[model samples]
Target: MGRKQSFTATELLDTTKRLVLEHGYDGFHLKLLSEHLPGARSTIYQYYSNKEEIVAACMKHVIVTVLEQASAVDETDAMSALQQLLLIYVGESQLHQLLGDAYKINTANSPAAANDLEFVEQAHLTLKSQLTRLFERAQQDKKLRNDIPLPVLVGVFFNLINTPNMLNIPTPQWSELLFQMWIGGARS
Candidate 1:
C-alpha cells in the first residue's frame, strides 16, 4: 500500500516557519530542510525552486493570511477598529519573527530582495488602506485630531504597529499605549 502524504503547502509553510525560527534563514537550505521536512529533497524543490523562492513563498503566504483575516474586522468605529487591529497586530508580531532570518537573506542579496520587498509592501499597503478609513471615520466623529495630514498619521501608526514585533518585546500595554497615542492625536 502507498503511504499517505501529510505534506501540503500549509505544511510547507509551517515547516518553513519552524526552520526559520530554529535554523535561521541562512540555515534553511535543502539539506537542512530535508531533515525536518520528512520528505525528499525533490519534494521540497517541487514546491519551491530555490531558497529565495522558498523564503518569498513563505513570507507571502503568512502576510496574505494576516491581511485577509485582518481586513474582515467588524468594528463599528475608529477606536474599535484600532483595538481590533492592535489585537491582530500583536498576534501578527510573533508570526513576523518567523521571517526574521528570511529578512536577513532578503536584505543581503539584491537578486531576491525585490520580491520580498514587494510582498512586504503589499502587506503594508493593505494595513495602510484599512487605517485610512478608520482615520477618516475618527476625523468625522471628532475622535481623532484632523490637523495632522492623513499620510503622516498613518505613518506614525504604522511605526507603532511594528514596534512590538521588531523588538521582540511584548509589553502588556504596548497596544493600549499605541492606540492611546494615535487616538489622542487622531481626535479632532
Candidate 2:
C-alpha cells in the first residue's frame, strides 16, 4: 500500500501563499517550501511538479476564496455591499500583491499551471464586473459623489486594500476602520 500523505493540499497552498508574499515569486522555491512542510522534499512532487504550477495553483486558490465571499454579498443595498466587499478585499490584502507576479509564471511547460492562471484571469473579470455593478448602483442612488468618475472611485476603493495597517489592528476591526476612512475621508 502507498504511504499516507503527511500534509494536506490546503496546508501546502497556505504555506505557498505566505512564502510568495514574503519572498516573492522569484525567490520562492520547492526547497524553501519543503523546509516549512511536514514531509520530505519529494513529497511536494506528488502534489505539484514545478514551482510555476504551485504558484499558479496558489493564486487560483486565493482568488476562488475572494470570489466566493464577494458573490455572497447582498447587493440590495449597494453602499452596504460596497462596505462588505471592502472588508473581503482587506482580509485578502495580500492577493493583489501575489497576483502582481502572475505574469512572471511561465506556464508553457505545465498545463495545470496554464489552466489555473486562466481561471484566475476569469475570476478577476468576474470580480471587476461585480464591483462595477455595485459602484454604478451606488452612484445612481446618490450615495457617492457625482463629481468623480466611477472608474476613479473604483480605483481608490480597490487601492484601500494596500493601505498599511501600522497599528496591527485585527482584520475585522481593521477592515471596518479602513472602510470608514474610505467613506468619510481623512478630514476632521
List pairs with backbone clashes in candidate 1: 143-187, 144-186, 144-187, 144-188, 145-186, 145-187, 145-188
lDDT tens digits, residue span 1-188, model 1: 66634478788877777787677777678777777766566788667667777777777777787888788998587778877787677656656566555545544555455576587667868776787788889778887778877788767766775664444445546677677766675666
TM-score for all models, in order of appearance = 0.66, 0.95
Per candidate, the number of residue pairs that clash is 7, 0
Q: Model 1 Cα displacement at 9 (Å)? A: 1.2
User: Which residue segments of model 2 deviate by more than 4 Å?
Assistant: 1-5
Per-candidate alpha-carbon RMSD to the true structure: 5.6, 2.1
- By TM-score, the best candidate is 2
Model 2: per-residue Cα lDDT over 73-178, one tens digit each = 9999999999999999999999989999999999889999999999999999999999999999988999999899998999899888989999898988888998
lDDT at 26 for candidate 2?
Answer: 94
